[model samples]
Target: MSSSPKNAMLAEHRNIPYVAAGVTNPLQEFDLYVPERRNTLDTRPPPLICFVHGGAWRSEDKAEHAGLARRLAAHTNFPVAVSNYRLTTASTPIRHPAHAEDLLAFLHFLLTWSGPHTSTPTPPYDPTRLYLIGHSCSAHMLTSIFLQPLDPASDSASRSPTPSRSPSPPPSPVPTPDSLIPSPALLAATRAVIMSEGIYDIDGLLVTYPAYKTWFIAPTFGRLRSYAPWNTASYRSRPGAEHLNWLILHSKGIPW
Candidate 1:
């Protein structure tokens, strides 16, 4: 007897390392969900849905969101990838750009991945057609990847390195110049971004919700002397930024 639609099976690949295993951090991994095809004759590759989770940028894992990924894959008949990234911790503090860097690495991996399945003859999803969905802080992370620096002068000034009296350990290496800057190919391939309750205006958020400062802002981004560097609302638009479609969702009750 044929299986019921409610009980349909999905092909799930778990803990697939996007970065070089053991060489880099272990959090740079993702879970992929592929729905079983009902039409045998349709051979066209489907678009990829890359989901970025939200947990104040300090909690949650890809494994925790497998159900969402499976549902997305099954509903849309498209492959879905739920990704993990380095999170801020008390013991080993992680800050801005680290989380976004890990995400960019995953994107690079997906763009160049060669389907090397030993058992199945099925091809991989089309990398050129990517639909990104990010929630909460994830919205900030995704924007950090695609948006240009808000102020080139200030950005360069900040990197000039001010003199300090007290000796301190070197700041964790910032992402390379090209790492945060999305390439033309990447921008072209990204079809759309859907941001839900996104934290775009950092300063605005802090002005309204003072509790966020203690909850996640300080922990994830350090003391906020100025929120300009972390704010996505003021980011400059590049050449390719206009081409991609964007959908921003916010609750009517909450001011976003």
Candidate 2:
């Protein structure tokens, strides 16, 4: 799925009631679309559903996906939080590492803001469930979480000496994917994660299809490896329906 429709959806359903992650940067802000449960005097902790928007990493707001949050909340009875990321129109290229950094920051905040749970429920909230859900162009949300563990903040040393003259070399698998985000202990605490119309096979998709290369994939991914989030190894780690309560729901009839 492309990032344009995701932007359109965000524009429509931004009128719900919930808390917001105040401006982390000059350009970014976040909102939480709490289900009707937050309205009552409920004692239980509701399950968390985190939504990440996609604008090729440059566009889309947290409020953009609030409708889907409301839908999920109403349907499944979960707490849904949406985040706005930093982006600028001038020289508006979102690039690679920047998007990864933005996502990692959001994830770190959520994990810190709300931790684990125990028991069943006190009154209205449910304790047995804790999940992460991302869809559309935001599929990179889950990808970033999995890839962060393996990459450094910036691989400046890897930059090509002659940028305009020659292209950078392909990425090597040296750092490995687990070196970045959470340790083994922390990973176990995560309940489940979902990606809709995932960009999991991004790097492969770029190389596999000539259409993407001519479009924006070549520039965005930056050579083969080069710390791009869409790399095969990083994307493969994502949990499917069986593994991490993950579900990659296509709109049906889409080629995928």
Candidate 3:
């Protein structure tokens, strides 16, 4: 759905509160928006799009785009949700991977947002057709955590000195014809996604990006590598995964 439909599905002012990231108190609050409308399909079921804010994973909030969410819901004829995630602070307990892990929790919240699975007694999801949108830091979290693969084998001695969200998974030679294919805990079924101005290159960005170095890629999610190389090639080689219909508004396109 486009912006048009999103603006069509909101109340004069509808607000929903959610915890997009963080594991403890003062985690943060997120707001859901629906534009004020009359005789609009706002009441009807429609697609859903979720947005992640950017602040280099250090800070950001849903209010950053609450208006956009409402306008989007009204114009696109879809429901829009924005979320908050953990960030790096100047105080004690500085855990770097906290942001990435928070996203996973948020994703879980999205998947089971409605229906049988909700943190609350009720589900917040309105429909499928999930589209994720992120800018800058949020994009890094979204892509690195959800899309990009890690090298997995690198470690203390041979590990690439970089500020990676994670390390390469420990060395495990690609599965042979005799081995069983590793299964995915999550499916690559995202309808579409948008990322703006991000350090997509995990290796290059991590080595240079200051924020990542401070975050703990090593202590947290682990130096988890990406899908098997074979899997990436196959997934990309497939019809939709390659096309992805992804919109990368950046200084350049993807490598190769």
Candidate 4:
């Protein structure tokens, strides 16, 4: 006989293929682990913890994070989604915003579950209880999306007037629109963020790793310093850097 209903709840669907790929290319995708026992009829749907994998934005793929996604889902009893983004390399060197844009697209797909090749039906979600976690270069991309400036042209309600999305205790005041304009649904629902070994200050990084200016930074960001909005310093003078709850994770001697 089949397992009991409670035991059956621990199910997983892999390689659902969220985005469509061309004849010879791999489209961006995410792996979602849904808890089996969650109540679909509850007043509020379960919260989600989305993870962005890190590869310095130049190496690695989403499948590498399957273990993490599975573990988190099992331990927390929360649906966990792990995603992959394009990487920059010598042969096909992409720039700074490329990763950011790719990740934003992933977020769009997650919230709406309506991409051209989405596999599953839109799962009920507590929009206001969403949390995002990113590691390494992915952390930087997540930060850019979080700290992005609200466009004055769009409806004010769509974007939070308070710019900063950091989840901090209090006090300590601090801190751009672009190709990435977040959806209204996502803006209203996002709650907190966790960044692991994130690269925040770009200019500072260049200053610290002089050779990287030519080897890495230039290839990824180009010579135009002002165009680099990924830098955390760029947000300092802007309004609204205190809207979301934030947690930053770092290891000693990592030097990010």
**Which candidate leads the pack in TM-score?**
1
Query: In model 3, which runs have C-alpha deviations exceeding 4 angstroms?
Result: 1-9, 12-28, 35-44, 115-127, 148-189, 202-244, 251-256
Instruction: For residues 130-158, write the lDDT of model 1, one tens digit per residue.
Output: 99999988998888888765445656423
Rate residue 208 of model 2 by lDDT: 52
What TM-score, computed on C-alpha atoms, does each candidate reach?
0.84, 0.61, 0.58, 0.72
Residue range 140-221, candidate 3, lDDT tens digits: 5555444433343542222333333544334223311112211132234456668877544444444455355336332322
* Candidate 1 residue 149 C-alpha distance from true site, Å: 2.4
The parts of candidate 4 lying over 4 Å away from their true place are 1-9, 17-27, 38-43, 114-120, 149-177, 223-229, 233-242
Model 1 reaches what TM-score against the true structure? 0.84
**How many residue pairs collide in each prediction?**
0, 5, 36, 11
lDDT accuracy of residue 66 in candidate 4: 71
Better structure of 2 and 3 per lDDT: 2
Ranking by TM-score: 1, 4, 2, 3
Question: Of the pair 1 and 2, which is ahead by TM-score?
Answer: 1
How far out, in Å, is residue 191 in model 4? 0.8
lDDT winner among the candidates?
1
157-209: candidate 4 lDDT, tens digit per residue: 22222322433122111113465556666665677889998887666666666
